[model samples]
Target: MDSPVQIPFKSFIQLDSKSATAIYLQIVFEFIKAIQLGFLPEGTKLPGSRILCRLLGVNRNTLIKAFDDLESQGFIKISASKGTFILSSQKQVVKKEGIRSLPNDLPVAVDFDFKKSNILDNPVEGSDLSLQFNDGLPDARLVHTDVLARLYVSKLKRNRNNGVWEQLQTQAHLNFKAQFCNYLNLTRGLKIAPLNLLTTTNHEISLFLVLKLLINAGDKVVVASPGYYFSNMSILDSGAQIISVTIDEEGINVINLREICKAHQIKVLYLTSVNLYPTTISLSAKRRIEILELAREYRFIIIEDDYDFEFHFDNNTVLPLAAIDTYKNVVYIGSFAKSLPAGFSYGFVSAPPDFIAELEKHQRILASGVDVIKEQVLTEWIEEGEVHRLAKKNKKIYKERRDYFVELLHLKLEGSIKFQVPNQGLAVWIEWLPSFSLIKFQKKCLDNGLFLPKTTLYQNKNLIATRLGFGSLNEKEMENAVAILQKSIAEVLIEIR
Candidate 1:
């Protein structure tokens, strides 16, 4: 072939050192864009990696990585002696930037009211929140992965006798279901069967599955006001109208819930009764019984999302609603996400076996069922008492962190914010004083490299409160975070004054 064509490279792209994107991936994207825009035509030989690196002011290794990625993705081809060439297969007409294509019959600019759906209407961009004050996430750095590795390797070796496909086909997961049943019975005071249990990837997925089975179009679903937004959004996605019931320190206002039931025939009631999301308040025992009775009377399914039950600070955690549920009206869900490291999160559902069967059937359509290796390893953890050991260890550490965070927060923020130290979970509900603005405080915190989840910034009438989680952060991190938070508060309060 003729000598490769050399093209000007400086006009195309520039790299930002502060950007989260890797330099190699940036190089790849720009090259893809260049090829698409016909600036580098098909069969065009790009400059050598060394030349390209010098031109772009990037490392030769980075340029090579970009070239390798491009070739792997079929964007470019490489030869033993020749440099990289843009593949002819990539030739296509590129849409002009800042322009729209409209049919001749339509108006150049359509004028119509486009209302955003509930899920799409969220003003909070998830990517902006870097330092998440998650409701109750475990410090994964503290998890004992060495024990898990041993168990996983042992199980892997044993599982080699049978193929992975065979393992998937058999009743292997039932062992975990059985193990979980026994564990729950011992810890939470519930008598359940393996058939009553269904494993899911996460609490959100389990909640969505349960809603799909219970909700119908036009049906009324009740959720606590300022509840888990994800669950509420899922209900809206299911074509059901949501009835928001207010929650106080005693949890979902049962009296108000009774009134809601009187007016609407509720098909489902979603709640994080163990430790209510964003507030970290447990549902009172009186309300628990009353709500179960209401569930029976109103003929609705109660979804109790006991999401971080493993990290209860107070030794006296109230039994989960499902543990005491007698009317078969409650579906309980929990996650080991907070008890162990991520990627090992084991979310599970315990409902009447018949309902679980339906949920499993729906699950099968979406997935090939659970990952047997993970299930096997987790089952070993439960059976060998490792799960209990980890939870017990984390609970003490979390309590200490929670207390330290509270002390630091009080020292720094004293009169500017008022809070109640939560009894059970990993976070505290702190109400901002009327003199300061929440949005402004959050912006200041973000500027200082601390991200507060928007869910934590709750507003009701004139009151503004946020749940500051302590479980995920260490004592040192908590101190730094609180110091930054105090500084942010001072700046915001000054502006307000």
Candidate 2:
């Protein structure tokens, strides 16, 4: 029999006085764990209670109690003349062959297998660099966080007495849904009621819920080439095969869509119609009507993601397709993330009431419920017209930034790039002329302390372009970023030569 000192009881057996479990019970659990793990062989003799109590920094009474419990549990055998010895159980072996010390840390990797998907990988990159460009995000600096906090606090104080269950039962968010419906109706020309709207934490979740309801595995879904990557990921994750169509300056080619519809049974058509992603071009009204007509004829559903509806810089901004969706063929998704501050942002789907009811069921499973306090605050924000006021303010500021950014691009990169002044949205799509390597350019820019996220870079056989967001950068930052871009392009071009 091995001596008790041969085993490292002090290393594995630890007691936490702060825990609700008694010290005696803790000791028993540790001893059983060590024995089952083969660290303590069946014939190993344990130290006396007086010695173990000092080693474990516990009272003699606690150590005695632990020993009694372990013996009663059949984990240990005590004799009058012999010391206590570990006993083998049917559940575990007591032989120390190929055994190592008991694990003192949590597992680093899962022991079981699960379905792994490369399709669901996140494309967005993070950077600690001060100068960075995103693919058309609202300026975080413009968000009135102080005002939002005040509103949140005020709502909390007023509802201090209301229990969470009671608040949920009352359905206080109904008022917010009603206000959001009215806001959408007035701004986007959508006639919807609270029952027709369902809100989620953000735009992606809203889209996911809608697709979960409508799409089945192996179904054919149509999207534009060089379209929103995140939405494409969601569609593929739902087991739907994606079919790509072309996008021109006027927007998605309805003629091409018509041909595809003839060839395939398309289930859903997804597009950001207000401002086509990566390229800030609005789908023309003529094409909108044609697409709606096609949807009616083909019996396909159109998902119009009017993500930046409130930030149109040009007077020719077209109303969303849902406005003229006479056949109930359009499911519209919109987000306050584009207009409001980050934390205060929310996304909602506006569709037929029955469709929304089904979507609410899906949301209940996925997200459980909306944040009560946030819903109330946003409800008051909309009802009190703060949402509108902020939208107007942001539009003016972003428009000026856009113009200034355009001017800088023309001045710094006159012959090297080609672009059109964006009519709507917060980004400008610039095609790189003379086609030097964009990957090299991205690297050079990074070395110079300017971060251009991979999500903003678009490359193909015929085109090399990037969607440069101007909304988040002020004039000084824009100028600095443009300078870095210019220098990087020059360096990359020289290397190619």
Candidate 3:
């Protein structure tokens, strides 16, 4: 006899036949509510299609069609190996419409309260901090939060008195992105127009929206294996399947991408283009063209997150795929949180202008609009040349930090760890010996009052690593963190040895 299955149903929909709303939409709204309440977690697996259809008493097509609708909206991820899982984090941050794929059967209702926070307020103890590898998060204290405060005040005042701010009044907000674009063109060689831009609340949102627009239900989406895990989360959560490609010193395996596409009908390809997560290796120029040509030939959309593109050590910048996209298939995304002080919250997405308009609709549909104050204040900062000035200064500082951190890291870890050298981007990706788990390594780091963005944040659990942001630490602090990490690793490695 087979053992009984366990499926979470606490947040499952209760359909009323006489109700005016459609049943599928009713299901969608209920799931969205569950997500908002944390009853459904990001990547929560649903039952198989036949099981879901039988349980819901709905036809397979209704479930399949509904899932396609939801996948397009960025709500859920469905894969052969993983079945179906919710895409959104229940934060109510983005629009999750009435869409979901039905898996075939039911199990016991899941106990949902078990899955909420991303960070442990007090993480598990004995985390490693001695080895010095970590991420670069801008100090919040350095940002113009006071101006942001005033911008919010002004927006509230204006909204209370005049109702919603008209789109006309907000046109000035484009200047924020416009100024950034000019800087990118002049300094980084990535030419972009204001018309091709859409701003989001953060870097992740840009990825979320891009995945939604390009991927359909059951479609194959390619990503670098051991790449950014959140991108994996976002892609899988979006109701599509994942195709993990190998990455090397140069970047994505272009030949592997072609093979995957050949074997599967890949709908989208996502890459960092500049410096990729975990590895920090920029895809080579020859490979970049190969990807573009393949995208055009295969009709797959290439999503270039270009995240942290502004932060490169070399005077020569790697141009975005969108900049060279004569076929208009490249969707280029940039983040303010990486370059500017994070917590200030601003980033922009640029694509074909028509797509920008469509994607902006998704952005508005997600947050109504970014915090009006963030946009305006950020606009002011950009126009004043402050954004570029700080960026230029920090770029050099971050480069120094990367160099020094690595120098000390080499001293401590020696042959125990490895990393890739990229021409651009923020985080230096380090791969630990297979003996180390980032989830375990990160826990060790947090115990020391030394918090680094865990490797899994960008890719999957198997990628045991962390992004050591030189931007987050100064010369003295850098040395201290490195020494601390070395001590942590030496102790751990000794036990294993």
Candidate 4:
């Protein structure tokens, strides 16, 4: 247009004709990347679309589309009747006379230090593996993300006229809490009220809250050996001494727990009653009753994490111990993550009203409150019966996947691995033959584009097992992963031989 304004960015924008990404998107991405990489400084004007199109050998419409996207994404700015210029690469950086300056200038260099807790460790960064089984997570694709987004948007608009503070203090939270208690009552046979429930971001947070309330320094708490590592971490963070009881076919050994309780003044006992973590074995009905009786006699707390209550295969699966906790000793917690979409994690703890009140106080100090918007949308989903619908749908799909996965395991590595056909949950516990090392097998799998973490490998003095989840994988991914796993086992076995 006016003699085609010149720019130095011609070398930065390269288009791959055969790329799966659209040409316009490629241009937009390159320009944004250039800004991010600081090749283009703040307020540096981009070449005119006419000149850019001629330089890049792209259609004028395509160039314009790229320019529009860059401007819309805040990577660039276009002034009417003026040229397009790069936005400040750092949003916080100010542009003065074409020079970027921080809003707050540092007087001196600052160094930061952080102390690592013995309980909580840093998160493991993920690799670019082709497929990896998670710890019994639901298929995110099955979640009604579109419906949830629409519901959230509707709630936002409805709350637009209300003040932010008012919105925070709205009855939506109370309503959701009530609905959640009702859901628990119907499903778990627990007569819980809204006052007995406290909602957190996830089960971990709920568990932490319970531990904080119950555990004191050097106080004794029992956990299953090689159990939910995160829960054990929470207990340690709360300054509680741990007594690990072994888990068997019927879940954690109650006899061992009784011995530990007698030896130590046990304050808390954390267990997954429905489907134990890693090992999807439900605690027997008799053990559940015994544990409840022991808790009352010993005056200890039971933190029940029923994370996969909805995925049971049988109709008459044992009701949660909390349902029949006559002494009000159980702090029942459950996660919506197994039932809802990814990025949506909400959990509730149903305990005595006094415990909940204390937990609420601590929760207020930690976070302002539960996400009101999310709470409202979830309430709508519950009332509309979408949660139940989705849970039922997920259970059906997971059951099918579980069956197919177990079948594939048998077909592929029948003699190499021993496993129990689980009745519920998303994973199968595969115990390796005595000859093979799971560590070597895991490393080989990771080397072959499958990311099985060592933490997923449960090893004691003699036993080695792993929980390979199938809920998140489709048929094709599952097949490929199983094949890789089989090959990996063979490779490891050959090395040992």
Candidate 5:
């Protein structure tokens, strides 16, 4: 057996007086780490308490406490005469030649094999540039932060006064569910009880739960050609094979979809019907009726992701398919974050009561339950009409931004790009007419201090387009970004020539 003095205890057993962890616990942890890493193998005898205390420059009492803890935890055996011996069963084997020094950090790679998922890789990109564009995200600055802060604090105080915080796990916050259901009924034309709705932290989780419940491995799922990338990832990650259908001005090609239905058994058809992602076009009323009829005939679920339903600027806005889904085949997914500020968003699913009950089971496994305090805050926000008030206020601001952005695009790149002024959402889909590379344009934009995320760029053999979000950019920022975009296009065209 190697003597404790042969092992470099002073090197591996590091301690910090300023650390918040207790000194004795720190010593105990260091010893456990050393043993596990083979620095101190099983049967290695440790120095006496007094000797170690002197060597490590630690207090005698602290060293003794560490030894006591190690022995209690079965990592060491303390004897009256022989000395403390390492007793850890998990200790790695060490050579008898000498003690080798290793890095203090833990191993980075695991020794065992496990499954890896490339389908779940994140497609979202982030940037720290002062000027940037996204795929139609809400403006964080326009959110009512002060009002939300006050409401949250007041609710917390009231909960504390009534001793409700202690019972948070049990409190269901049914009032919020009732108010949410009522809000949907009035705004989106859905008649649902509190039990028919299920709330989640965000749209992705809500859709994930619904897909996991309905889809199985090798199941066939249909999505639009240039669909929402994140939702498509989720569908593929659930082990379902994705089938793409073309989308046009009217929305998804229902005629083509019916042909596909005739050929294969599709388990689900996921779409952003209200304002189609990237395109910002609504599924026409005629197409909505036809799609619903096909769903009834073929017995497939329609996941209508009406993510930005409240941000529609058009006067002739159409209601969601769920509003007129008499066959109960439409599973509607929506988010409240588009109306609120950055962190205060919540997502929900509207389905049958029985389906919701089944979803709750999966939700409990994923997240124990929704935050009771947040639910209460939203309940008060909805009941006092603050939610609607904010939605109305922000809609006016976003519409103005959209108009200004469209004007700038026309003024700067009239012949170089072609686009439609989207009437429903915060983004405008601009198709670039030039044959220059979109990737080269993105690189040039970055060099000029403007970041255009890869997710916002859509390119194929037939099309070169980008979804430029104006909601988050004010007039001055929009002007600057557009100038940079125009300059980058000119530079790319020069390179191509």
Candidate 6:
């Protein structure tokens, strides 16, 4: 097909061999000029590379190279099925006078309206139950904004007005990191240096930065099957091959991963070893040790997502593999986003000194570095005993909520719903099978103002289970939610029968 977004070659195929400019580059500039002139709109797809090569009467290699150069510069995008299309541009493209108007045969209008990739508009925003189950980040209502206000005020008053930029190695920043280390040592028993922890804006940024250092594009990484669906998206975005190891009731099937390791050279073994998603089972301690041993023998790294280590509402607290990774093979990841607060915007990566150095380099390259003062505030929270105090306070409140939710279920719908009381977690995993799909149950529950995420949100669409986040719902709300859920489940079962 001809280019929908076309640039009539204003200049002949002039091979300027004597000049420094390559012939392909000469053609590239002319094409760019057309795009700047409004000849190409947003939806307009460029001709096939072969067609472009033929029309320009240039070598196919040179044409393809020019196309690649344009793509890398963000002037155009190469879609999977739609071919190349004009990307958002800032400068204008000027066209020559007396050019014929756009052909009547062309359908797509070339508009340079740039926008970010589509974002999922969550219906949970501003929901009445929003405070209860919107576990994506720290609720603005919950964070102590006054603390942040003071910190930023200090920067303006002390640092900027004096013409002294805040030193990255200031005493405040260092103290914060040290306190973070102390929290880890106390909770997980891993005595990390404050310098070893690199606080990130969030988990997604943290994972992306770590993966860049540890994984080359197209390298093989292993993850638990039906795992955090988002992890698979992240891995694939990094251009890495994902090997899905089956997860059973005991968490990741370590035995199967080992067999895959024998068959293929794996780069990273990613697991949410702490209260893994969809199914709230942490890896057995024996398998945790076995996984690290395998890492040492196989020369790969273990990406441990201790995402919710603090909320384990159980006395027999499960240990994270990072706590016992004496060999430095485990890259420990912790996030306070789901644990205590959000907008503190902190998650950490704890690894060996070498990986830590490489991670800093990667941060510089990736621009996902932590804010110095935010780190300080968190460290102060730890030192001032706010974290532990908050944890202890929330524990009583959340545990009561969990117990109330469970008790209410027993009273309202005992035989129909089955779930486990997790050792320590805000959410409980439930399995229901008088043959009712969770989505069907969710739809029924939504009518009564009780909103919960179905298991399909975390795993494959076919998997039928539900995750009830009790941490966000209070005692009165818990009983109310339970009553609504009981009716919801009954409605689902009635349809199934």
For the record, the alpha-carbon RMSD of candidate 1 to the native fold, in angstroms, is: 15.7
lDDT digits (tens) for residues 1-497 of candidate 1: 35432466666554544222356655765676666455676788877777778889999887887687677556788987976788876432111111112232533334787653423224233434335566556677887788778877887787777756674535667777888889888887778998888888877788878878888899888888666756766887788887888888889999999999999888889888988886778889899899999998888888888877777777687889999889988889887645656668877889888999999999998787567888888878788887887777777888888889889988988987887788777788888886444545665786676777545666534567777878889877888788888888888777767
Model 3 TM: 0.67
Stretches of candidate 3 above 4 Å error? 1-134, 144-168, 174-184, 187-191, 341-343, 369-374, 420-422, 433-466
* RMSD to the hidden true structure, all candidates: 15.7, 19.3, 13.0, 17.6, 18.3, 14.0
Candidate 2's error at 231, in angstroms? 0.6
* Model 1 lDDT on a 0 to 1 scale: 0.74
How does candidate 2 score on lDDT?
Answer: 0.80
Candidate 6 Cα deviation (angstroms), residue 265: 2.0
State how far residue 55 of model 3 sits from its true place (Å). 22
Error of 4 at 27 (Å): 49
Which run of 10 residues does model 2 get worst, by summed lDDT? 90-99
| Candidate 3 local distance difference test against the native | 0.64
**What clash count does candidate 5 reach?**
0
Angstrom error of the Cα, residue 250, model 1: value is: 1.1
lDDT of 3 by residue, 26-123 (tens): 45545545554455557677778788777777788767766754554456776778577787442232312112222325442676656543211221
For every model shown, what is its TM-score relative to the native structure?
0.74, 0.77, 0.67, 0.76, 0.77, 0.69
- Where does candidate 1 clash, by residue pair? none
Q: Which stretches of candidate 5 lie over 4 Å from their true place?
A: 1-108, 164-172
